[model samples]
Target: MLIAETSEGKRVNLSQLSREEITGLKKKKHYCPGCKSEIIVKNGTVIMPHFAHKKNSQCFFFSENESEEHLVGKKLIAANCEKYGIDYELEAFLPELQQRPDVLINRKIAVEFQCSPLSIARFKERTINYQAFGYQVLWILGTKLQWKDSCSSMQRQFVYLSKNIGFYVWELDISKKEIRNNYFLVSSIWKKFYQTQLFSLEKESVIDILQFPLKNHEEVSYEIASKVACEKRIHCWNQQLNQKSKSSLQLQEFFYQEGLNLRELPVEIMLPSFQSVLLKEQELIWRFQIYQRIQRDKKMSYQSLYRMLKQNFDKNYPLISDCQLIKYHLSLYLCFLLQNKLIIEKEGYYYPTNKKFTLKKTSQEFLGIPLKYGMINK
Candidate 1:
């Protein structure tokens, strides 16, 4: 029905009213601000029917006044919705009715652009309105147009209400950007540095690189390794004894530090199940020597690896082990490196597989592999 302004007041014009508007009013017939019955428009006249329920009737009212921030936030959300090609509508605001969210998207989306904190009561009211309307709301935390501020804090979280637990809201960190960046980094690194196109395995690394590029692949790997080493800085080698002699004490210490010896070091470092594990002290001296020799000869055999580790450790620390034990340890050490995928194995021999190591295949694809530390299962 059409609403007309007359000397008496606003009146309804049934003849001029379209079928759609009538249906709309009918759908809203049960809605009343006070404990009143359905108000129906009929035959160029408006009639207010009586109702029994007084204070218990459900009703909603609307006006058109909103806070300045609310207006600005709604405009921003509208802009974003337009950019993302989303459908939305701005509901009318009423006086002192604890404003509904800034914008409602696609009838099912609620966006609360929260720049300033609100009381628990106000926040709950706005959230409840969206929830009641069956809208999935996004409470945008942080200030407006502050990209760097948003990126700076690593602990921003999202909260939403649930139907099962009345008024109960759950919170979780934002993961979309982080996950996206990681994937991109892995993909780029795989195509560029490693020359491989296997984007699947390079998931986290790819994402990390995309989010924060630290340089080429070799530089990145060395960076992680160096950081891991420097944090602990555990001196595994003794420098005093071999200082005056031609002893290969530095090489022995490197092996010991890296656990590249006859006996394989146990991976777990449990201390009452509470303390963190100590960092793996790699045999830098021995590893460097092996690395150099492989680069120089263009290949490394079991004989060379054994001679290097055994001679250095035995000569410098003679009472460390016997000949038989030393041989077994060297074999086991090489096997460990191969198992961890730190070194490449080809034709009964091992070689470093990092960016620094030269490979037979010149056209090999290098991809960024994500490195994760601590527990694997959990």
Candidate 2:
């Protein structure tokens, strides 16, 4: 709420004014641009100078308790837009959508500086609403919402996919006065990892940095779990099964009904693929399902396999706009099988080789054969 409209309909930006100027302006009346409700100016030494709605005023656009971090971050983005001479409207309210973004760039890009917790339903609704009106919404996380070792379900909803950067999220740091592009993000069973690219608000143009991935044609490479690491992860899953954990017990029961042993899953079950993030089920579970289908059918078409995997995919990821990721991951897994001579494809049908599934004494023996673990080419 940095910008407020005067009685004469002229917009006033408190961020651009000095303390004395703001103090003088407190004498006049101002209103919120969104709800057109009367707002009071707060010139406090603790927090940044901004407009606040009167007590008991129920404004749909302005929150009663907007955090200090959110206000600062919003003003920082507005300053960056000003620095670049980019045409932007601060806290612009769209009547049709009844949503007020922190900053609207060129009347198309809605920059939302989310410093507080938001429900997934509301987040999805806002995102879908913006997209419906041809507005591209960019969600930038504040310090409070940034991910550490691994992302929570809510944090995962902020991740966006791209060819050059793979999966990415944006973060704003007020202290650093910089925006971070955490890209090529991948997750293991235990943790998540990614590389970061920082853009200084003082030196970089926000528009150019945001468009870099869209314009760049080169692909990015990320390391997957090593062979030993993959084996250890499977060994951990076996340990959970031995402990009779509820989830593990459920999976084991399902496998037992299908005449399969959870402890002796094949090496192919744990291979890493970028699209693994799309599913909440373990890679071993879904991969074994694929193997079982191939075994029973003897041969299957790509469409059929895709439909089968779709049943298990975790479709809760709302930010990942691409609907064909399941197809992409399935194709990658099939290619790996083809490369290893474990499966042969001819006339659009995949035929499994006569590779026998055997019992293994140790986890090390599960991945005895050397295999690739990361991204696969189609």
Candidate 3:
């Protein structure tokens, strides 16, 4: 909340002020630009000088408290935008939408630097409302975002979309004083994996604060991610091989009855489903269902698959992004099956190749066989 208005109604940006100017402002008594509440000039030596509401001032955007990290992050970003001539205002109100963004960029794009957690419902409502206002909303995350190696499922709901990138994290690197745009072409949160041929963010201006870990970073990072995906997949399979559980017994009972051990399953059977952010069901289960349904009906249709999975997939699960994941997963995996010749596509329908898959009427394949086969797809 660095920007405020003077008694004379002139806009004041506190971050741009010197210590002497700040002292003068303290005597002048500025007020919040948005709420018109009296504000105080805080010029502490430990942190950047910014304005705060005089004790107990209630603002509309206060359903959640702003942390110290949140304050610093917004100030830095607003200051950086100023330095770059990005044309921004801190906490500018959008009249039509009756909403305020942390930083209004170019009087069009609304940038929010979220440092804390919010429910999925509130997040979606804000995003949808912003979109309804015809203002592009960019969520620049502070501290809460994690890289692939250390990602947790709880943070999945923070995912957002940008034009070029399918799903991206606008990350705040507080220590480095820079931002990172981690764009993913395809990823699986369940696997803690992202598959993008490259990840590159460069400084396009003097105040441009984005950084890619290495030059031509996509090539190096992609190689590493690919290796990690393979290793993790094999590691999971081996772990399952060594473990004792009802799941193991159930898997063995079903697939073994079909004379197919895990290794004998097709490589393409368990290929990772792309960008399944909200999908709680394992890819193996749905893919197996597709194989079985196709065998019974002699065809797989997108509508049919969606209808079937909708019955069992958890609608109660929290969704983080705008995409309908269950629909996308079904479509993408079916496309994979068709591409690998495991299933033949005729017009809009898909038919399984059970005989060529080494199927026999002699034994019934476990319904979980597909899940078991595809569990390690990474």
Q: List per-prediction Cα lDDT, in the order shown.
A: 0.35, 0.75, 0.59
Error at 311, model 2, angstroms: 5.7
Query: Candidate 2 versus the native: TM-score?
Result: 0.85
- Candidate 3, poorest ten consecutive residues by summed lDDT: 364-373
lDDT, residue 169, candidate 2: 88
lDDT of 2 by residue, 1-378 (tens): 788999999999988899999999988999998889999999988888889999889888888777788888888888988998999988888999999999999999999998878888889899989989989999999987886775566777887876555667899999898999887666665666567889898898789879855655434444443455556666876889778888778877877887877766566665542335445445556677777788789999988988887765666655674355565456557756776567888999989997643323322211100112333222
* Candidate order, TM-score descending: 2, 3, 1
Ordering by lDDT: 2, 3, 1
Please list the residue runs of candidate 3 whose C-alpha ends up more than 4 Å from where it truly belongs after superposition: 62-68, 148-154, 161-166, 185-191, 195-202, 205-277, 282-289, 301-328, 356-378
lDDT of model number 3: 0.59
Ten residues in sequence with the least summed lDDT for candidate 2: 363-372
lDDT tens per residue, model 1, 1-378: 112223333333322345566555443333222222334333222321111122443434322222344434444445445555667544323234334445556656555555544555555566556555555555654343222212211111222111111111111112221211111111110121111112221133222222232332332221122222222222222332335323344444545775664122222111001110110122434444555576566578878776766664622111112353344334434443454455677997767665322122211221112331221111
Candidate 3: residue 331 lDDT (0-100): 58
